[model samples]
Target: MAAFTTGEAVALDLPIARVPTRATAFILDLVVQIGLALVLGLIATLMIALMGADSAWIDVAVTTVIVGTLVGYPVVCETLMRGRTVGKLVLGLRVVRTDGGPIDFRHALTRGLTGAIVDFWMLGGFGAIAVITSMCSPNARRVGDVLAGTVVIYGQKQLPAPALAVPPPWLANWVVQLDLSGIPEDLALAMRQYETRFRTLTPAAQVGLGQSLVITVCTRLGVAPPGNFPAMQIIGAVIAERQRRALTPPYSNPELLGLTPAALAAVRG
Candidate 1:
Protein backbone atom coordinates (compact mmCIF):
# COMPACT_ATOMS: atom_id res chain seq x y z
CA MET A 1 0.00 0.00 0.00
CA ALA A 2 1.09 3.55 -0.68
CA ALA A 3 -0.19 6.78 0.81
CA PHE A 4 -0.39 9.97 -1.21
CA THR A 5 -1.68 13.43 -0.45
CA THR A 6 -3.59 15.04 -3.27
CA GLY A 7 -3.30 18.66 -4.32
CA GLU A 8 -6.57 19.21 -2.51
CA ALA A 9 -4.91 18.08 0.72
CA VAL A 10 -6.77 14.81 0.77
CA ALA A 11 -4.82 11.69 1.61
CA LEU A 12 -5.29 8.44 -0.31
CA ASP A 13 -4.10 4.96 0.59
CA LEU A 14 -3.91 2.95 -2.62
CA PRO A 15 -2.88 -0.70 -2.96
CA ILE A 16 0.17 -1.00 -5.20
CA ALA A 17 0.41 -3.66 -7.88
CA ARG A 18 3.38 -5.93 -7.16
CA VAL A 19 5.77 -7.52 -9.65
CA PRO A 20 3.90 -10.81 -10.01
CA THR A 21 0.63 -9.22 -11.05
CA ARG A 22 2.40 -6.63 -13.16
CA ALA A 23 4.43 -9.30 -14.90
CA THR A 24 1.30 -11.25 -15.69
CA ALA A 25 -0.33 -8.16 -17.14
CA PHE A 26 2.81 -7.43 -19.09
CA ILE A 27 2.88 -10.95 -20.54
CA LEU A 28 -0.73 -10.66 -21.55
CA ASP A 29 -0.01 -7.34 -23.22
CA LEU A 30 3.05 -8.81 -24.92
CA VAL A 31 0.92 -11.57 -26.36
CA VAL A 32 -1.48 -9.01 -27.74
CA GLN A 33 1.31 -6.87 -29.13
CA ILE A 34 2.96 -9.85 -30.78
CA GLY A 35 -0.33 -11.02 -32.26
CA LEU A 36 -1.02 -7.52 -33.61
CA ALA A 37 2.53 -7.25 -34.98
CA LEU A 38 2.22 -10.55 -36.81
CA VAL A 39 -1.12 -9.67 -38.36
CA LEU A 40 0.01 -6.17 -39.40
CA GLY A 41 3.34 -7.45 -40.68
CA LEU A 42 1.55 -10.03 -42.82
CA ILE A 43 -0.75 -7.36 -44.23
CA ALA A 44 2.20 -5.11 -44.96
CA THR A 45 4.08 -7.90 -46.70
CA LEU A 46 1.05 -8.73 -48.78
CA MET A 47 0.62 -5.09 -49.72
CA ILE A 48 4.26 -4.83 -50.69
CA ALA A 49 4.07 -7.96 -52.85
CA LEU A 50 0.94 -6.71 -54.60
CA MET A 51 2.55 -3.33 -55.24
CA GLY A 52 5.78 -4.91 -56.50
CA ALA A 53 7.69 -2.71 -54.03
CA ASP A 54 11.48 -3.00 -53.85
CA SER A 55 13.43 -4.90 -51.16
CA ALA A 56 14.26 -1.61 -49.38
CA TRP A 57 10.56 -0.93 -48.84
CA ILE A 58 10.24 -4.34 -47.19
CA ASP A 59 12.77 -3.31 -44.56
CA VAL A 60 10.94 -0.05 -43.98
CA ALA A 61 7.62 -1.85 -43.52
CA VAL A 62 9.19 -4.27 -41.02
CA THR A 63 10.75 -1.44 -39.02
CA THR A 64 7.46 0.44 -39.00
CA VAL A 65 5.61 -2.61 -37.70
CA ILE A 66 8.13 -3.19 -34.92
CA VAL A 67 8.19 0.41 -33.72
CA GLY A 68 4.44 0.88 -33.99
CA THR A 69 3.64 -2.30 -32.08
CA LEU A 70 6.32 -1.71 -29.46
CA VAL A 71 5.54 1.92 -28.73
CA GLY A 72 2.23 2.98 -30.22
CA TYR A 73 0.07 0.24 -28.68
CA PRO A 74 0.66 1.14 -25.04
CA VAL A 75 0.60 4.87 -25.67
CA VAL A 76 -2.70 4.81 -27.51
CA CYS A 77 -4.33 2.29 -25.19
CA GLU A 78 -3.40 4.04 -21.96
CA THR A 79 -4.39 7.42 -23.30
CA LEU A 80 -7.74 6.25 -24.61
CA MET A 81 -8.54 3.96 -21.71
CA ARG A 82 -7.46 6.40 -19.01
CA GLY A 83 -4.31 4.65 -17.86
CA ARG A 84 -5.28 1.08 -18.69
CA THR A 85 -3.94 -1.12 -21.44
CA VAL A 86 -6.05 -4.12 -22.51
CA GLY A 87 -4.11 -6.36 -20.13
CA LYS A 88 -4.33 -3.91 -17.28
CA LEU A 89 -8.05 -3.47 -17.80
CA VAL A 90 -8.51 -7.23 -17.64
CA LEU A 91 -6.43 -7.50 -14.46
CA GLY A 92 -8.09 -4.52 -12.71
CA LEU A 93 -4.86 -2.56 -12.74
CA ARG A 94 -4.36 1.10 -13.63
CA VAL A 95 -1.44 3.46 -13.91
CA VAL A 96 -1.87 6.66 -11.92
CA ARG A 97 0.18 9.69 -11.05
CA THR A 98 2.33 9.70 -7.91
CA ASP A 99 -0.27 11.89 -6.23
CA GLY A 100 -2.91 9.18 -6.82
CA GLY A 101 -4.65 10.95 -9.70
CA PRO A 102 -5.53 9.74 -13.20
CA ILE A 103 -2.67 10.06 -15.67
CA ASP A 104 -2.75 12.06 -18.94
CA PHE A 105 -1.35 11.42 -22.42
CA ARG A 106 2.01 13.02 -21.72
CA HIS A 107 2.53 10.66 -18.83
CA ALA A 108 1.44 7.72 -20.97
CA LEU A 109 3.83 8.70 -23.78
CA THR A 110 6.78 8.97 -21.42
CA ARG A 111 6.02 5.63 -19.78
CA GLY A 112 5.54 3.91 -23.13
CA LEU A 113 8.79 5.27 -24.54
CA THR A 114 10.79 4.46 -21.40
CA GLY A 115 9.27 0.98 -21.25
CA ALA A 116 10.37 0.17 -24.80
CA ILE A 117 13.80 1.77 -24.60
CA VAL A 118 14.82 1.16 -21.01
CA ASP A 119 12.53 -1.14 -19.05
CA PHE A 120 11.99 -4.13 -21.33
CA TRP A 121 13.47 -3.94 -24.80
CA MET A 122 16.65 -2.15 -25.74
CA LEU A 123 18.63 -1.85 -22.49
CA GLY A 124 16.50 -3.88 -20.05
CA GLY A 125 18.02 -7.35 -20.68
CA PHE A 126 14.45 -8.60 -21.21
CA GLY A 127 13.04 -7.07 -17.98
CA ALA A 128 15.97 -7.57 -15.60
CA ILE A 129 16.18 -3.86 -14.81
CA ALA A 130 12.41 -3.60 -14.34
CA VAL A 131 12.30 -6.54 -11.94
CA ILE A 132 15.25 -5.30 -9.92
CA THR A 133 13.93 -1.78 -9.70
CA SER A 134 10.48 -2.95 -8.64
CA MET A 135 11.97 -5.21 -5.98
CA CYS A 136 13.99 -2.34 -4.57
CA SER A 137 11.25 0.30 -4.70
CA PRO A 138 8.78 0.22 -1.83
CA ASN A 139 5.84 1.00 -4.15
CA ALA A 140 6.82 -1.60 -6.76
CA ARG A 141 7.45 1.09 -9.37
CA ARG A 142 9.55 0.23 -12.43
CA VAL A 143 11.92 2.43 -14.45
CA GLY A 144 9.11 3.82 -16.60
CA ASP A 145 6.99 4.54 -13.56
CA VAL A 146 9.89 6.32 -11.85
CA LEU A 147 10.61 8.41 -14.90
CA ALA A 148 6.99 9.20 -15.71
CA GLY A 149 5.97 9.88 -12.09
CA THR A 150 3.44 7.09 -12.24
CA VAL A 151 2.64 3.84 -10.40
CA VAL A 152 0.52 0.83 -11.20
CA ILE A 153 -2.11 -0.04 -8.62
CA TYR A 154 -4.80 -2.64 -8.11
CA GLY A 155 -7.69 -0.46 -9.14
CA GLN A 156 -10.73 -2.68 -8.71
CA LYS A 157 -10.94 -4.41 -5.36
CA GLN A 158 -14.48 -5.19 -4.23
CA LEU A 159 -15.04 -4.32 -0.60
CA PRO A 160 -18.18 -3.93 1.45
CA ALA A 161 -19.44 -0.40 1.88
CA PRO A 162 -18.38 1.26 5.09
CA ALA A 163 -21.04 1.73 7.72
CA LEU A 164 -22.41 5.23 7.99
CA ALA A 165 -20.80 7.43 10.59
CA VAL A 166 -22.98 8.49 13.54
CA PRO A 167 -22.48 12.03 14.65
CA PRO A 168 -21.97 12.76 18.33
CA PRO A 169 -25.09 14.11 20.04
CA TRP A 170 -23.43 17.46 20.71
CA LEU A 171 -22.55 18.06 17.06
CA ALA A 172 -25.56 16.59 15.29
CA ASN A 173 -27.50 19.89 15.08
CA TRP A 174 -24.48 21.87 13.96
CA VAL A 175 -23.57 19.28 11.32
CA VAL A 176 -27.01 19.25 9.73
CA GLN A 177 -27.11 23.00 9.49
CA LEU A 178 -23.78 23.48 7.72
CA ASP A 179 -23.73 23.70 3.91
CA LEU A 180 -22.03 20.68 2.35
CA SER A 181 -22.22 21.79 -1.28
CA GLY A 182 -18.65 23.05 -1.22
CA ILE A 183 -17.15 19.62 -0.53
CA PRO A 184 -15.91 18.05 -3.74
CA GLU A 185 -16.33 14.39 -4.58
CA ASP A 186 -12.64 13.66 -4.13
CA LEU A 187 -12.61 15.21 -0.69
CA ALA A 188 -15.68 13.22 0.27
CA LEU A 189 -13.99 10.05 -0.93
CA ALA A 190 -10.97 10.92 1.16
CA MET A 191 -13.18 11.37 4.21
CA ARG A 192 -14.83 8.02 3.66
CA GLN A 193 -11.46 6.32 3.24
CA TYR A 194 -10.18 7.91 6.42
CA GLU A 195 -13.27 6.82 8.30
CA THR A 196 -13.09 3.24 7.04
CA ARG A 197 -9.38 2.95 7.88
CA PHE A 198 -9.60 4.84 11.17
CA ARG A 199 -9.39 1.79 13.41
CA THR A 200 -6.27 0.44 11.73
CA LEU A 201 -4.24 3.55 12.46
CA THR A 202 -1.91 3.82 15.47
CA PRO A 203 -2.92 6.14 18.29
CA ALA A 204 -0.56 8.91 17.23
CA ALA A 205 -1.47 8.52 13.58
CA GLN A 206 -5.14 8.65 14.46
CA VAL A 207 -4.74 11.90 16.29
CA GLY A 208 -2.55 13.61 13.71
CA LEU A 209 -4.36 12.49 10.61
CA GLY A 210 -7.76 12.94 12.14
CA GLN A 211 -6.91 16.48 13.17
CA SER A 212 -5.58 17.30 9.76
CA LEU A 213 -8.71 15.97 8.06
CA VAL A 214 -10.92 17.86 10.46
CA ILE A 215 -9.13 21.07 9.54
CA THR A 216 -9.47 20.35 5.85
CA VAL A 217 -13.16 19.54 6.13
CA CYS A 218 -13.84 22.63 8.20
CA THR A 219 -12.04 24.78 5.70
CA ARG A 220 -14.05 23.43 2.82
CA LEU A 221 -17.31 24.03 4.67
CA GLY A 222 -16.22 27.59 5.40
CA VAL A 223 -16.65 27.04 9.10
CA ALA A 224 -14.53 26.77 12.22
CA PRO A 225 -13.65 23.48 13.81
CA PRO A 226 -15.23 22.88 17.17
CA GLY A 227 -12.61 23.31 19.86
CA ASN A 228 -13.74 20.71 22.36
CA PHE A 229 -15.05 17.93 20.10
CA PRO A 230 -13.05 14.83 19.22
CA ALA A 231 -11.82 15.00 15.65
CA MET A 232 -13.20 11.57 14.91
CA GLN A 233 -16.68 12.50 16.04
CA ILE A 234 -16.51 15.75 14.12
CA ILE A 235 -15.54 13.89 10.98
CA GLY A 236 -18.25 11.30 11.55
CA ALA A 237 -20.83 14.03 12.00
CA VAL A 238 -19.86 15.69 8.74
CA ILE A 239 -20.00 12.43 6.83
CA ALA A 240 -23.27 11.46 8.42
CA GLU A 241 -24.74 14.82 7.53
CA ARG A 242 -23.56 14.48 3.97
CA GLN A 243 -25.11 11.04 3.67
CA ARG A 244 -28.30 12.26 5.23
CA ARG A 245 -28.60 15.11 2.80
CA ALA A 246 -28.00 12.74 -0.08
CA LEU A 247 -30.92 10.58 0.92
CA THR A 248 -33.24 13.45 1.75
CA PRO A 249 -35.33 15.09 -0.95
CA PRO A 250 -33.87 18.36 -2.13
CA TYR A 251 -37.15 20.25 -1.96
CA SER A 252 -38.18 19.01 1.48
CA ASN A 253 -36.44 20.33 4.55
CA PRO A 254 -35.72 17.88 7.35
CA GLU A 255 -36.78 20.53 9.84
CA LEU A 256 -40.09 20.95 8.01
CA LEU A 257 -40.50 17.16 7.96
CA GLY A 258 -40.54 17.28 11.78
CA LEU A 259 -37.14 15.59 12.07
CA THR A 260 -35.22 16.89 15.08
CA PRO A 261 -31.51 16.45 15.74
CA ALA A 262 -32.26 13.46 17.97
CA ALA A 263 -34.37 11.90 15.22
CA LEU A 264 -31.65 12.54 12.65
CA ALA A 265 -29.06 10.91 14.88
CA ALA A 266 -31.35 7.91 15.38
CA VAL A 267 -31.87 7.60 11.63
CA ARG A 268 -28.12 7.61 11.06
CA GLY A 269 -27.58 5.06 13.82
Candidate 2:
Protein backbone atom coordinates (compact mmCIF):
# COMPACT_ATOMS: atom_id res chain seq x y z
CA MET A 1 0.00 0.00 0.00
CA ALA A 2 1.28 3.45 -0.85
CA ALA A 3 1.07 5.86 2.10
CA PHE A 4 0.05 9.35 0.98
CA THR A 5 0.41 11.88 3.74
CA THR A 6 -1.66 15.05 3.34
CA GLY A 7 -0.53 18.55 4.37
CA GLU A 8 -2.85 18.27 7.37
CA ALA A 9 -0.78 15.29 8.62
CA VAL A 10 -3.34 12.69 7.63
CA ALA A 11 -1.93 9.55 6.00
CA LEU A 12 -4.00 7.61 3.47
CA ASP A 13 -3.23 4.22 1.93
CA LEU A 14 -3.80 4.42 -1.84
CA PRO A 15 -2.89 2.12 -4.71
CA ILE A 16 0.00 3.46 -6.78
CA ALA A 17 -0.55 3.26 -10.54
CA ARG A 18 2.22 1.13 -12.02
CA VAL A 19 4.08 1.45 -15.29
CA PRO A 20 1.80 -0.89 -17.29
CA THR A 21 -1.35 0.98 -16.30
CA ARG A 22 0.30 4.31 -16.90
CA ALA A 23 1.54 3.23 -20.30
CA THR A 24 -1.93 2.07 -21.28
CA ALA A 25 -3.39 5.38 -20.21
CA PHE A 26 -0.73 7.26 -22.13
CA ILE A 27 -1.35 5.23 -25.30
CA LEU A 28 -5.06 5.91 -25.08
CA ASP A 29 -4.40 9.61 -24.61
CA LEU A 30 -1.93 9.56 -27.51
CA VAL A 31 -4.48 8.03 -29.88
CA VAL A 32 -7.02 10.71 -29.03
CA GLN A 33 -4.42 13.48 -29.36
CA ILE A 34 -3.30 12.16 -32.72
CA GLY A 35 -6.88 12.00 -33.88
CA LEU A 36 -7.45 15.60 -32.82
CA ALA A 37 -4.31 16.71 -34.65
CA LEU A 38 -5.40 14.91 -37.78
CA VAL A 39 -8.83 16.56 -37.72
CA LEU A 40 -7.23 19.96 -37.21
CA GLY A 41 -4.73 19.26 -39.99
CA LEU A 42 -7.51 18.32 -42.37
CA ILE A 43 -9.30 21.55 -41.63
CA ALA A 44 -6.09 23.52 -42.09
CA THR A 45 -5.37 21.73 -45.36
CA LEU A 46 -8.85 22.54 -46.67
CA MET A 47 -8.52 26.16 -45.64
CA ILE A 48 -5.08 26.45 -47.25
CA ALA A 49 -6.26 24.88 -50.50
CA LEU A 50 -9.31 27.13 -50.67
CA MET A 51 -7.15 30.20 -50.10
CA GLY A 52 -4.47 29.02 -52.58
CA ALA A 53 -1.82 29.35 -49.88
CA ASP A 54 1.86 28.49 -50.57
CA SER A 55 3.22 24.99 -49.74
CA ALA A 56 5.67 26.45 -47.18
CA TRP A 57 2.84 28.14 -45.26
CA ILE A 58 0.79 24.94 -45.24
CA ASP A 59 3.72 22.94 -43.87
CA VAL A 60 4.35 25.50 -41.12
CA ALA A 61 0.64 25.64 -40.15
CA VAL A 62 0.36 21.84 -39.93
CA THR A 63 3.51 21.54 -37.81
CA THR A 64 2.37 24.38 -35.55
CA VAL A 65 -1.13 22.90 -35.15
CA ILE A 66 0.19 19.40 -34.29
CA VAL A 67 2.73 20.71 -31.79
CA GLY A 68 0.23 23.03 -30.11
CA THR A 69 -2.42 20.32 -29.93
CA LEU A 70 0.01 17.85 -28.37
CA VAL A 71 1.04 20.28 -25.64
CA GLY A 72 -2.27 22.08 -25.10
CA TYR A 73 -4.39 18.93 -24.84
CA PRO A 74 -2.86 17.68 -21.58
CA VAL A 75 -2.55 21.13 -20.06
CA VAL A 76 -6.19 21.99 -20.68
CA CYS A 77 -7.49 18.58 -19.62
CA GLU A 78 -5.42 18.23 -16.47
CA THR A 79 -5.95 21.78 -15.27
CA LEU A 80 -9.66 22.12 -15.97
CA MET A 81 -10.56 18.55 -15.08
CA ARG A 82 -8.52 18.45 -11.88
CA GLY A 83 -5.95 15.99 -13.26
CA ARG A 84 -8.27 13.70 -15.20
CA THR A 85 -7.71 13.59 -18.95
CA VAL A 86 -9.91 11.56 -21.29
CA GLY A 87 -7.50 8.60 -20.86
CA LYS A 88 -7.15 9.01 -17.10
CA LEU A 89 -10.93 9.22 -16.70
CA VAL A 90 -11.32 5.94 -18.59
CA LEU A 91 -8.49 4.28 -16.61
CA GLY A 92 -9.53 5.73 -13.21
CA LEU A 93 -6.18 7.44 -12.74
CA ARG A 94 -5.53 11.01 -11.60
CA VAL A 95 -2.45 13.12 -11.15
CA VAL A 96 -2.25 14.63 -7.67
CA ARG A 97 0.40 16.26 -5.59
CA THR A 98 2.80 14.07 -3.58
CA ASP A 99 0.80 15.22 -0.56
CA GLY A 100 -2.49 14.11 -2.20
CA GLY A 101 -3.89 17.63 -2.69
CA PRO A 102 -5.60 18.82 -5.89
CA ILE A 103 -3.07 20.07 -8.43
CA ASP A 104 -3.42 23.57 -9.95
CA PHE A 105 -2.50 25.01 -13.33
CA ARG A 106 1.19 25.32 -12.50
CA HIS A 107 1.50 21.59 -11.87
CA ALA A 108 -0.45 20.74 -15.05
CA LEU A 109 1.62 23.17 -17.14
CA THR A 110 4.92 21.81 -15.82
CA ARG A 111 3.92 18.20 -16.44
CA GLY A 112 2.68 18.94 -19.99
CA LEU A 113 5.75 20.97 -20.98
CA THR A 114 8.30 18.48 -19.64
CA GLY A 115 6.30 15.47 -20.85
CA ALA A 116 6.50 16.82 -24.41
CA ILE A 117 10.28 16.66 -24.17
CA VAL A 118 11.39 13.59 -22.15
CA ASP A 119 8.30 11.48 -22.78
CA PHE A 120 7.59 12.14 -26.45
CA TRP A 121 9.89 14.34 -28.53
CA MET A 122 13.26 12.79 -27.76
CA LEU A 123 14.36 9.39 -29.20
CA GLY A 124 11.78 9.20 -31.97
CA GLY A 125 8.77 9.53 -29.61
CA PHE A 126 9.52 6.12 -28.02
CA GLY A 127 9.32 7.48 -24.42
CA ALA A 128 12.52 5.57 -23.58
CA ILE A 129 13.65 8.18 -21.04
CA ALA A 130 10.20 8.26 -19.39
CA VAL A 131 10.04 4.45 -19.23
CA ILE A 132 13.51 4.18 -17.69
CA THR A 133 12.77 6.95 -15.24
CA SER A 134 9.46 5.36 -14.23
CA MET A 135 11.24 2.01 -13.69
CA CYS A 136 13.89 3.66 -11.52
CA SER A 137 11.51 5.76 -9.38
CA PRO A 138 9.62 4.03 -6.59
CA ASN A 139 6.42 5.94 -7.38
CA ALA A 140 6.81 5.49 -11.15
CA ARG A 141 7.43 9.24 -11.46
CA ARG A 142 8.42 10.33 -14.96
CA VAL A 143 10.35 13.54 -15.72
CA GLY A 144 7.12 15.58 -15.62
CA ASP A 145 5.91 14.12 -12.30
CA VAL A 146 9.34 14.70 -10.78
CA LEU A 147 9.51 18.31 -11.97
CA ALA A 148 5.88 19.04 -11.12
CA GLY A 149 5.91 17.35 -7.70
CA THR A 150 2.98 15.12 -8.63
CA VAL A 151 2.02 11.43 -8.56
CA VAL A 152 -0.52 9.49 -10.58
CA ILE A 153 -2.67 7.32 -8.33
CA TYR A 154 -5.90 5.35 -8.35
CA GLY A 155 -8.55 8.09 -8.27
CA GLN A 156 -11.08 6.42 -6.02
CA LYS A 157 -11.81 7.72 -2.56
CA GLN A 158 -9.80 6.35 0.37
CA LEU A 159 -10.52 5.93 4.10
CA PRO A 160 -12.90 8.17 5.99
CA ALA A 161 -11.60 11.21 7.83
CA PRO A 162 -10.98 11.22 11.57
CA ALA A 163 -13.01 13.38 13.95
CA LEU A 164 -11.28 16.72 14.46
CA ALA A 165 -11.02 18.84 17.58
CA VAL A 166 -13.35 21.81 18.00
CA PRO A 167 -12.39 25.15 19.51
CA PRO A 168 -14.46 26.42 22.43
CA PRO A 169 -16.74 29.36 21.75
CA TRP A 170 -15.22 31.59 24.44
CA LEU A 171 -11.51 31.04 23.71
CA ALA A 172 -11.80 31.32 19.92
CA ASN A 173 -10.88 35.00 19.92
CA TRP A 174 -7.80 34.54 22.08
CA VAL A 175 -6.47 31.35 20.42
CA VAL A 176 -6.48 32.75 16.88
CA GLN A 177 -3.73 35.26 17.70
CA LEU A 178 -1.10 32.59 18.35
CA ASP A 179 1.63 31.92 15.79
CA LEU A 180 1.35 28.17 15.19
CA SER A 181 4.19 27.74 12.67
CA GLY A 182 6.63 26.56 15.37
CA ILE A 183 4.46 23.54 16.23
CA PRO A 184 6.12 20.41 14.77
CA GLU A 185 4.14 18.03 12.54
CA ASP A 186 4.55 15.06 14.85
CA LEU A 187 3.48 17.17 17.77
CA ALA A 188 0.41 18.26 15.83
CA LEU A 189 -0.35 14.63 15.01
CA ALA A 190 0.00 13.73 18.65
CA MET A 191 -2.41 16.52 19.55
CA ARG A 192 -4.93 15.15 17.05
CA GLN A 193 -4.55 11.63 18.47
CA TYR A 194 -4.98 12.96 21.97
CA GLU A 195 -8.09 14.88 20.96
CA THR A 196 -9.61 11.85 19.28
CA ARG A 197 -9.03 9.48 22.21
CA PHE A 198 -9.22 11.84 25.15
CA ARG A 199 -12.56 10.45 26.30
CA THR A 200 -10.97 7.04 26.90
CA LEU A 201 -8.25 8.41 29.17
CA THR A 202 -8.76 8.32 32.92
CA PRO A 203 -9.31 11.73 34.55
CA ALA A 204 -5.84 11.74 36.20
CA ALA A 205 -4.13 10.62 32.99
CA GLN A 206 -6.08 13.20 31.01
CA VAL A 207 -5.10 16.03 33.31
CA GLY A 208 -1.40 15.13 33.22
CA LEU A 209 -1.07 14.67 29.46
CA GLY A 210 -3.41 17.52 28.67
CA GLN A 211 -1.50 19.94 30.87
CA SER A 212 1.80 18.80 29.36
CA LEU A 213 0.52 19.26 25.81
CA VAL A 214 -0.92 22.68 26.54
CA ILE A 215 2.35 23.80 28.11
CA THR A 216 4.40 22.53 25.16
CA VAL A 217 2.16 24.09 22.55
CA CYS A 218 1.84 27.31 24.46
CA THR A 219 5.63 27.50 24.72
CA ARG A 220 5.95 26.92 20.97
CA LEU A 221 3.42 29.62 20.14
CA GLY A 222 5.11 31.96 22.65
CA VAL A 223 1.86 32.53 24.51
CA ALA A 224 0.96 32.20 28.14
CA PRO A 225 -1.89 29.94 29.23
CA PRO A 226 -5.47 31.18 29.55
CA GLY A 227 -6.13 30.91 33.29
CA ASN A 228 -9.79 29.78 33.31
CA PHE A 229 -9.81 27.55 30.20
CA PRO A 230 -9.22 23.81 30.33
CA ALA A 231 -5.93 22.49 28.88
CA MET A 232 -7.72 20.32 26.32
CA GLN A 233 -9.75 23.32 25.20
CA ILE A 234 -6.56 25.27 24.56
CA ILE A 235 -5.02 22.43 22.59
CA GLY A 236 -8.20 21.86 20.60
CA ALA A 237 -8.52 25.55 19.82
CA VAL A 238 -5.02 25.74 18.35
CA ILE A 239 -5.55 22.66 16.19
CA ALA A 240 -8.89 23.94 14.92
CA GLU A 241 -7.44 27.36 14.20
CA ARG A 242 -4.53 25.89 12.26
CA GLN A 243 -6.97 23.87 10.19
CA ARG A 244 -9.10 26.93 9.43
CA ARG A 245 -5.98 28.83 8.39
CA ALA A 246 -5.10 26.05 5.98
CA LEU A 247 -8.52 26.25 4.35
CA THR A 248 -8.45 30.04 4.22
CA PRO A 249 -6.50 31.47 1.31
CA PRO A 250 -4.20 34.42 1.75
CA TYR A 251 -5.50 37.84 0.55
CA SER A 252 -9.06 36.57 0.75
CA ASN A 253 -12.02 38.72 1.83
CA PRO A 254 -11.22 37.65 5.37
CA GLU A 255 -8.20 39.95 5.13
CA LEU A 256 -10.35 42.94 4.27
CA LEU A 257 -11.14 43.33 7.94
CA GLY A 258 -8.46 45.08 9.97
CA LEU A 259 -8.33 41.91 12.07
CA THR A 260 -5.62 39.28 11.60
CA PRO A 261 -6.53 35.94 10.01
CA ALA A 262 -6.78 34.10 13.27
CA ALA A 263 -8.94 36.86 14.69
CA LEU A 264 -11.04 37.00 11.53
CA ALA A 265 -11.59 33.25 11.65
CA ALA A 266 -12.52 33.56 15.28
CA VAL A 267 -15.11 36.18 14.33
CA ARG A 268 -16.39 33.98 11.52
CA GLY A 269 -16.57 30.97 13.77
Highest TM-score against the true fold, candidate: 2
Question: Model 2: runs farther than 4 Å from truth?
Answer: 50-60, 123-125, 159-171, 174-269
lDDT of 2 by residue, 1-269 (tens): 47876544466887888889988998999999988888888888888989899989888887778677877899999998878899998999988888676777899999998888777665426787788889899898898999999999988763333334579998899887778779985688678767767899999979999999998888888888987677788888988887667546662433111233344445556
lDDT of 1 by residue, 1-269 (tens): 88875422345688999999999999999999999999999999999999999999999999899888999999999998878999999999998878665677888999999999999999998999999999999999999999999999997732212245678889988998899888875677677777777888899988998899899999999999977788888988888887666547773344311233454556546
Specify the poorest-scoring 10-residue window by lDDT in model 1.
251-260
Top-lDDT structure, candidate number: 1
TM-score of each: 0.59, 0.65
